[model samples]
Target: MDVTGLIPDFGNLAFTIVAFVVALSIIVFIHEYGHYIVGRWTGIKADVFSIGIGPVLLKRMDKHGTQWQIAAFPVGGYVKFRGDANAASAGVDEGAIAGLTPEERRATMPGAPVWARALTVAAGPVFNFVLSVIIFFGMAYYQGIATDPLTVKQMAPISGVENTLEPGDEILSIAGLPTPELAEFGAYVETLPDESPLDYTVLRDGAEVTVTTLHPYPAFVGSVTPQTAAADAGLERGDLILAVNGARTATFEDLRAFVGAGDGEPLTLTINRGGEEMDVELTPRRMDLPLPDGGFETRWLIGIGGGLIFEPATRAPSVGEAFTGGVEHVRYIITSSLSGLWHMITGAISSCNLRGPIGIAETSGAAASQGVPDFIWFIAVLSTAVGLLNLFPIPVLDGGHLVFHAYEAVVGRPPSDRAMRVLLAAGLAVVLAIMVLGITNDLFCP
Candidate 1:
């Protein structure tokens, strides 16, 4: 992804990585801070708190005895409680410290009130959601304050709906929710079902016109491919496929699955040719897709070019409108994330799309290619997802702790160690299983 005007001399890889680091640090801090402040307010002493896991790169101890450290891995962070299974392992000795004087004894994580512990854990995820909301609001307000043409001429090419939408197209609402930013317009399209109804209300020439069109996309497209049919087909950048075989595609995931099913046969394709649908034939060539475990398999892909396009809007949203729209965007994300999770658990959708860190990095890198605003939007959506997922009632998660707290409230004590250990073990298994599926999704499905 080259920035044509701004960074003609700079590489985007460096920028993407740096942007990822900055965004991660900010989000992680917000999440961890929720725990730190809540623990302190709840009369609990958090001895050490650090973001990320694995090896520590640097560290310092404050006068209050809290160790502030930066770890080599910056994906996420945690606060160590006074005690759990081991104290010495984490650089603190709970049993030995208890026998020392008040000044000499070390504060442990377990002695904190049960409610405090629960809140501390819960706060981390909560802050993630809060950060997403703030970022979303900023982007929304920025859009509202600036005006785009509100028509297809200046709209982005990847803008699934807005590009075709007219200047006077009244942006009544999206997915039953309202947003003022053109960026949010893409978000709404991303969430729509590939096969379901794609509905929208637009005001054309002062009349509310409903234009419900199918989403035209195949699958996730990216750089770094060694060799592929698309490369062989002479497909150039900025060429977006509006439809394939006459069926309008909305998402890449949609178009990809369709092409793969054709088994290397020539298929009719409708591309947005100079803002018009032009017919083309894509005969997918087979390529051996590498497997995660080292095996290789061939997959069919048509030689075609496609990508996202966002048109510059002539009209922007007002500050107040953008603020309101931002809030709604975050709320929509939170709700949609929870709903998607439910579907994942209930078998409504394929679990193959569930991703781990690899998926996140790939997504971040791809979004970064789209634009800075696109990357920021991706982070906000992911943050909402992280927050909602943490709320799942499973052991070792915030929601699980909350469940335990509720049980304590009723019974006046925590569960037995044997039971807690069993629960933790079960939770660990579930988490690992999810990881496996995530890796599978990344390699096999999408």
Candidate 2:
């Protein structure tokens, strides 16, 4: 056995470890602090508030006698309230409680009022949810709110329908249905049983024009490739390429054809944004792009991607709207996660979606490599996942503790200490099994 070879080669491994540690620490600290602060608010005394487990690497005592510590491990953390036997807050120290005065005894987890204990236990996940909402709100506020009457920006590259629509076409109705707004149009399109030829009524040249074609794709700009002519010309997501070289081009394919035919020549672009119009001058770059099937096609292009049929106008939203958006975003994440898990459990989807510490660490490193904002966004996502996981009704978790507390409330006394221990042990086993499965999937699943 080569003991010397047991140590990992540093280099990129070191960076990944650091990023993982930082991300985990932020999440763990906030979660534990939730318990600590809420416990204090409820008159519960916390003994040790630790981020991570095992041997302590750093420690400081607050004025209130709470020992806040950073431990050697960086994956998870906990809070040990006064008179608790361990970090999980599973068992109480009866002898320790007996030795203290009545007021001091009330400060321990077991001696605290049932409501206080439950509230303190619940606060951890609540805080996590709050953090997610706040982050989401900030993101929404920064991105601006999308409002609209559907206007075509770019179209799909499909051949037959390319000539039927124009980039500046304001979609008044489709398939004999009036779609006064982008959302309504999207709803109508999504409900279609199958792709069929449809009549599209659009406003162009100060008149209503009706055309028949299969609406293959949205005119929304999907992406703008960095360092490309589109980026240089200030073409952005949601910016509609209304007309190309003073000629009305309807579909995304039309925009592509015009740019391809430009052959590196400068072209005039009429752009519409939130009902405002402007002209831009850009020269297409000749470049080779890879086809999804295989090989490459050399073409003249201004780097841009188009999807989504309608260009929804955007404007700054009110604070209330931002808050509502934040809540909706969190609800969507939770609902989607639960749905995915349910599908996986029912064999409707692959269980390989489950990830372990290694997978998470690698993701953290990759996100950090992208940029600080991307990393922060990743952390927020991880925070939401972690919060959701902790709320599962498994033993040895905050949710499990609350479940026990609820039983005690109903039955007028806590479960026997021995019974508590057995349940905790079972819970530990279940949690460990899940961890093993996650890691196993990470290593072996393709």
Candidate 3:
């Protein structure tokens, strides 16, 4: 177990608490508001809209007689529809609507149409998804899509190369394909065999020229962290590792394998810097990195990041494209999450992949420390997870209600009150058990 896992720093702990609160509050508000607004639209009255649970901190009665309030806790929230037994809307309040007229009774949760109740319950998760999509679309719009008029700002140095590409050379085509953008060039590269020589059409000095270049996956340096062995040894951006300890490394993976095999020993490196060959020596440092399961593992590192084959170039996408990208992003997350869960169930992966509230709080703080954009992106990701989780076909979840609705539709009536009570209790137990398991993993996993 990592030392940080046993005891966290005070400053980090404070940030974690604050970030977790903010994230939870946003997600819960969006979820509860969905139920409240939809219920109102469906002609069912809502008695209260509350963020968090327990004692109310601030309350205001809307003109429509709905009590809006903020409560003491900030973990989760609920919306209490009128004439409901409790906030979960599990059953109806018979006494509350006993003497009301037909029109008045129809405006209460107990008297609303079956379809209206279903819609109201389903809205919570749907709204969470919508929030994620909107955030994703905003991120897409801000970053835009990468395009190409590919110009070489810098070239990775490779040893034994006689003809080096210049900085001003604009690559017009590769392998007989008219590469107008980086995306096309990347696709073309992916199709070709590694380390093979290819012909390229380049625009240099106001003229087009054809050149033959090897497609070797050199250890291209993308970044060097301060105070690291690589940085101290004078490695710079765009430098390429031609050989490690006199052995040629054709790919970044090869370099990693060699470094990781070392027992924190010094490494001999043959670097190619702008066609110039040089040698350097550096020792790998052991660093601990966080894991998804709320654990950490130490790894040998030179503090260098590699494998960026393109420059930063982006173009503004159309509104339609932005929305499509957002939807695709959410879909990707849901697909991957379900796939992971299935793999875990089959024992193909470790169960430690499950994270609890503590893990989420830790992640929230870490993301916040990175920057606002990073934190917002993290929030969007968490929102997507929340929405997807709520749709699991377990009792007490929105998906469970949906399943109940489907059953009622087929049988022409809801489940018996006793049956509903039993199912809800069972669901609550399963949910709590999962939470406990997650917390256990966070505390004891290695």
For candidate 3, the lDDT comes to: 0.78
Listed in order, each prediction's TM-score against the native is 0.62, 0.66, 0.74
The lDDT ranking, best first, is: 3, 2, 1
Predictions in order: lDDT: 0.61, 0.76, 0.78
On TM-score, the stronger of 2 and 3 is: 3
Off by over 4 Å in 2: 1-12, 148-313
User: Could you tell me how far off, in angstroms, the CA of residue 260 lies in candidate 1 after the best superposition?
Assistant: 14
Candidate 2 lDDT, tens digit per residue, 344-370? 687655677677887787677756755
Off by over 4 Å in 3: 1-7, 151-181, 187-252, 255-310
| Model 1 stretches with alpha carbons more than 4 Å out | 1-25, 83-108, 145-320
Summing lDDT over every window of 10 consecutive residues in candidate 2, give the lowest-scoring window: 1-10
Among all windows of 10 consecutive residues in model 3, the one with the lowest summed lDDT is 153-162
lDDT of 2 at 169: 80
Q: How far is candidate 2 from the true structure (C-alpha RMSD, Å)?
A: 12.1
